[model samples]
Target: MTILKNRLFWPAAILVALLIVNAFTSNQFVTVRDGHLFGSLIDILRGSAPLVLVALGMTLVIATGGIDLSVGSVMAISGAVACLLISDLGNQNSVGSVLLIIVIAIAVSLLAGLWNGALVALVGIQPIIATLILMVAGRGIAQLITDGQIINVQSGPYATIATGFFLALPVAFLIAVAAVVLITLLTRRTALGLLLESVGGSPTASRLAGIRSRRITTMVYVVSGGFAGLAGLIYSANIKSADSISAGNLIELDAILAVVIGGTALIGGRFSIAGTVLGAVLIQALGVTVVAVGVPPEATLLFKAVVVVALCLSQSAAFREKVFGRFTSTRTEAIA
Candidate 1:
């Protein structure tokens, strides 16, 4: 009974509720045909890949009591860099060019991250203020790379990163899964996860305990930026164009919202990559539902915002305590 009433139970229940609603409202919501799933089900996972990747990164940053407002812009920069390289090379089939471009893109993103980390970690700048500089400047760099115009590159290998699939699931989804797994191993399998949470939960205590909190904080942002860069490449590959103006616009909001909805406290400490993935899928599903039902496309954004608000409210401290407090068992209470 105590386990059933744990704080995470309600969020899990709400996730199931959304899934049930989706199934009932759309005839094709859960259909599996010819070894492929279609309708809202496919749309959710497909749309969520970038968000999942970004959210995984966000979880780490938030865990260290920092935020990377520049992720979306970094994504744009990464995409622009990748597309320009492919366009300059004149073909995606040029394996040498492809490899070189990816390396350059990753390097650029890491450099941006290093700058952010230096500002926050060494110069003692506030996370918001430091990243805000790049958030504004990064997009300008992306536009400059594209010569202030969208660049289109039609390449099978490039498009395959986004639009292609393996074993009927999206390649993007697979990549997101792999990223989550790797990060989980890095944090959970090592001492890093606990140390990060310790730092976030109480920085002074962690520092007194001999944790190198500053270094960990810096690393979080760099990893976050790298993930954002990867998302940019996937997104650009999907669309086959690098649109500086619109690619990844407001995606930071989506990622932060997903992180919050995943039951990860925005104030920092605990992180859950699996929960973030679920939250990403749920938001994406809501968008698909709005579209498949013939509602105005613009309304989808508004609905997504509403979902975020509701999820946040339900996952708030007061709600969790009130709804889940009563089922505590004597044995568990004693253990606590």
Candidate 2:
């Protein structure tokens, strides 16, 4: 009963509901091709990678009671950086070329993150306003890198970063797993998670306790931006082209939604990486359900909005305490 009462329950319920619906609605959805779940399941995971990655970062940020609204822009910046660097290689040195491009992409992403950290931690700017600066300017930087045009690259290794397969799983899935594992290890295995929660629970108290809440808060944003940058690389690699306008449009919103739906309170102090991943999968599955049912993509966003509203409502304290409480009491009586 307690497990069901936990905040994670709502997302788990929705995820299961979607799976049941998908199983009945689409023949191909349950079908497995080779060793992988084909059709909508694959589509769900494929479309989910970028959102999952961003949400992973957002999980930590929200844990610190901060938000990063500039993730989409960071994605744009990183994609443009990778495309430009790879394009410049032009068959220069093969292994060295690939290493250089990947290294530059990681470096640029970290730098972008550091920029966000500095402004928020050192300058004492509001998180939203500070990231908004990058949110607006980051795409322009991407445009400058590509000269305001879509950059097309025909690199095999680069393309594989997005489209490649390893051990019958998508590379993006592996990356998402690695990120979650690392973060889980960091937070659960060390005092950092404890400090983050302490900070989010009450910044002043944490500061009084000698916790560098400001630095932790800023570090979350940097991590968020860096992950967004990595997501951008995966996205562009999947498509083999970089279009500034379409690369990461409105992705920040999706990532935020995922974090919210994952049982993370937007007000902060709590984080659930597993729940967030489940939420991302559910959101992507919702899109697949819309498409599988022959609904127009135009109406899809509206449906998603409705689902999101319901999910958020279910997360409210009143609703959870009421509905879940009643259900639990009823079950207890029956058992007695």
Candidate 3:
């Protein structure tokens, strides 16, 4: 009964329902071909990888009572850095060049993360405002790096990061899974998760208790930035080009939505990485469902909006109490 009452329950149920619906609507929704999983389900996992990464980072930030609106822009910047580096290399296909490019992009992202952390922690700026500064300027910075042009690179290994298969699964999906597992271990297996929740729940009280709220808050933003950068790499690899304008556009919203749907409160405190992963998967599934059910491309966003509203409402305790409370009371009375 307690498990059923958990915040994750409704979201998980909705996700399962969506999968069933997809299976019924599409004959090939789940299929195995040539010893590789090939279906709308696999497609959803592959497509959702970047969003999952972003949401994972968002989860940590939100757990610390902060938000990162600059994730999308960070994605753009990282992708631009990587693709530009690869383009400038004498041999774009050289394995060493691709490896160096990846390292440079990730390094730049970490620096951006450090900058965001400094503003929020050292300057005492609100998280939203602090991140917004980067959010607004980061894309322009990316355009400057790319010289207002899309950067194209032709490298099999680089392309494989997004499109290749590893052990019969998409590399992108594997990356997401690995991230989830790594974060889960880091948060659950140590005291970090509890300390973060303490700071988010009440900074003053945590500070009095000897918790370094400032440092914890800054770390979350840094983690968020790093995740966004990795997501950028995946996005760029998918299209074989980094278009500064289009890369990771509006992705921050999706990541936040995923975190919310995963049962994380905006006010901060408790967080569930598993729940966030499920939420990302659900969002991806919803997009795939719209197309599979023959919804017009023009109305896809509307349909998604409706579904999101329904899911959020269904998960609301007040709404559930108003609708199901009376029924539960009646059942209890009858049993008594």
For all candidates in order, the CA lDDT equals 0.82, 0.82, 0.91
The sequence of per-residue lDDT tens digits that candidate 3 reaches over residues 1-336 is: 677678888888888988888898887886777767878889999999999999999999999889899999999999999998888888778988798889889889988888888998889999999999999999999999999999898878889889888888999999999999999999999999899899888988999999999999889888899989999999999999999999989999999999999988789898989989989999999998888889999999999999999989988889888878988999999999
Q: How well does candidate 1 match the true structure in TM-score terms?
A: 0.88
- lDDT (C-alpha) at residue 41 in model 3: 86
TM agreement with the true structure for every prediction: 0.88, 0.91, 0.95
Instruction: Give the clashing residue pairs of candidate 3, or none.
Output: none
Candidate 2 per-residue lDDT, tens place, 1-336, comes to 667657778778887788777777787764555775556666677778888989998888888877888888888888898888887775833766876787788678878888888888789887788888988998898899899998888888887767666877777877878888998899989998889888888888999999998889878887887889889999988888778878788888888888887777788787778888888888888877777777777888898788888888777889877887899999999999
Instruction: Let me know the TM-score candidate 3 reaches against the reference structure.
Output: 0.95
* Runs of candidate 3 exceeding 4 Å displacement: 1-3, 327-336
Q: Of the pair 1 and 2, which is ahead by TM-score?
A: 2
RMSD of 3: 1.9
Q: Which of the predicted structures, 1 or 3, would earn the higher TM-score when compared with the native?
A: 3
The parts of candidate 1 lying over 4 Å away from their true place are 1-4, 24-27, 30-37, 320-336
